[model samples]
Target: MTTLYLLGSAAPPVLEISQVIEDAQGRGYDVCLGLTPSAARWLAPQLAELERLTGHPVRSEYKAPMTADVWPRADVALFAPATFNSINSWAMGFTSSFVVGYAAEAIGKRIPLVAMPCVNAAYAQHRALDRSIAELRGMGVTVLYGPGGFEPNQPGEYRAEGYPWGLALDVVGAMVSPTT
Candidate 1:
């Protein structure tokens, strides 16, 4: 089975990750969940259930050196509902959280990567976001922003139900498809 590292940030859409995981699994992926530290804290109550659903420990922090890995090696990584901070940090190569760290290293490892941001319109206007998106793209990550992916909504008009998990999964499907 292709192991997909389904990573997320603390956006409102992160709350619906269980359904996203199920959707990825249904599409023929062995999903492993990773989240930013803040996202892990936000989903603390459901951590165990998430672990059970993926059959792997949800990771938020870096493990100690020489420690063995808990999840299968990732065949691909999809970071969704990526927040403004997470996007910037990742582009800047600040690997403070396990999710960003793994993603940064994945680029060097040449692992196929995809990301979709969930910034509000106000946050999306920040110059840093554009630079970060471009930087990740330059590094060969398939960042699904703008048309056909998550579009920024008005500040405080956040709707978690509107996140584009299916679109991200579709891209993942193509990446993992044998024909591709």
Candidate 2:
């Protein structure tokens, strides 16, 4: 099975993560989820349910080095609703959490990485976001942003509209199976 690392950050769309997981599964991917600490807290009520969806525990904190990794090696990675912190931290190689650690590693490990940020318009204007996007793109991570991917919503208000969840999955699908 083609394993996909579905990494989530503390963003508005973390609430709808299960739908994305199911979407990935529908595309024949074996999904593995890792969330930032804050995201984990937000999804606390759904962790067990998420495990059932992926058949693996959702990992947030770093396990001891000696501990066995329950999830398989990822063939590709998707950082959905990737927050401003995650993008900056990942580009700067900050790995305080499991998701960021895995994301940081994916660049060098040469596992295809795709990211879609869900930052608000004001925050998206930060210099760090531009630099981070450029840096990650320079390293071959597929950033789903700009005009097509994630348009920043106004501050204090996320879209009451649905997120384009399938766009990320479509990008990953194309990456994983180009001929398809």
Candidate 3:
């Protein structure tokens, strides 16, 4: 079984991350979600729904009693709608929350890490953010950004006509696919 660790952030776009989890579950991948404190405030209801749909718990802290291990052993880890703060924190080795802690643990184990950053152009274009992204890349993390020029509104508020949830599912598919 392929394990997918969905890391959360406080950014508004994280509200839609459950859709990606739901899509992956539909494809028969075992998915577990970890939420940051801010992310829980923005989208706990949606996270609850995802848990119901996926039949798995949504973890916010490491101490929470989970059915099984949910970190380090995941086949793939995706931090979608990652906030600028989260990008820097992860790059700097700050693992305070379950989301950050799980990512850090996964990095130690050399698990595939994918991050889709959601931030305004100014923050996204900042030198510090660039350096963080580069640092994560150096560590073999896949960083995905939305198209340039188009600005997304505040988190949990922006809505694209047809968001690319399928692409994320494709990535999960590839991560879970068996080698012949």
Candidate 4:
């Protein structure tokens, strides 16, 4: 089976995460979602709905050691609605959250990966975000940013139509081509 790890952050676009799952599945991926702690809280009300869509758990916390893994091992991973905080933290090797933790290790595991940032223009201006993006790209993660991917909106002007969930999914499909 072609399994995908769909990771989300607590960005505004996370409210419409079902689309991300839908896109992944449409591209023939068996979706498994992981949320940052804040994202898990934000998406709490829709946890069951998300589970229904992915047909798997929406994991936030680390599974207890020695427990059988609930989701299939990832053939590819996509991190969307990737917040400024999550990106910076992951780049700095902070694995406090399941998504970041997996991403940190996925690089070494050679898992095909994609990341789509949901930062606004104001936050995008931060030097640290640039550093983080650069670092992730340097590590061979396909970061979908700038034109044709994700573009920062003006702060406070987030429109759901503007998020690039589709772009992230498309990149995933390409990465997994002839993949299984």
Maximum-lDDT candidate = 1
lDDT (tens digit, per residue) of candidate 3 on 1-180: 677777878865566776677677767667778888888877766766877876677878777475566333578888876778888899999888778877777778998888777677658567888898888888888776555312444544545553455665566566666222
lDDT of 4 by residue, 1-180 (tens): 699898999998888888877876776788898999999999999999999999998999999999999998888998988999999999999899999999999999999989999998999989999999999999999999898888888989957687867777878888885244
Q: Estimate each model's TM-score.
A: 0.96, 0.95, 0.81, 0.94
| Model 1 weakest 10-residue run by lDDT | 171-180
Q: Scored by CA lDDT, what does every candidate get?
A: 0.92, 0.90, 0.72, 0.89
TM-score between candidate 3 and the true structure: 0.81
User: Candidate 2, residues 95-128: lDDT per residue as tens digits?
Assistant: 8889989888878889999999888989987899
Model 3 C-alpha lDDT versus the unseen true structure? 0.72
Count: clashes, candidate 1 = 0
Give stretches of model 3 more than 4 Å off.
64-72, 146-163, 178-180
Q: Which candidate achieves the best TM-score against the true structure?
A: 1
Candidate 1 vs 2: which has more TM-score = 1
Clash counts per candidate, in order, are 0, 0, 2, 0
**RMSD in angstroms, all models?**
1.9, 1.8, 3.7, 1.5
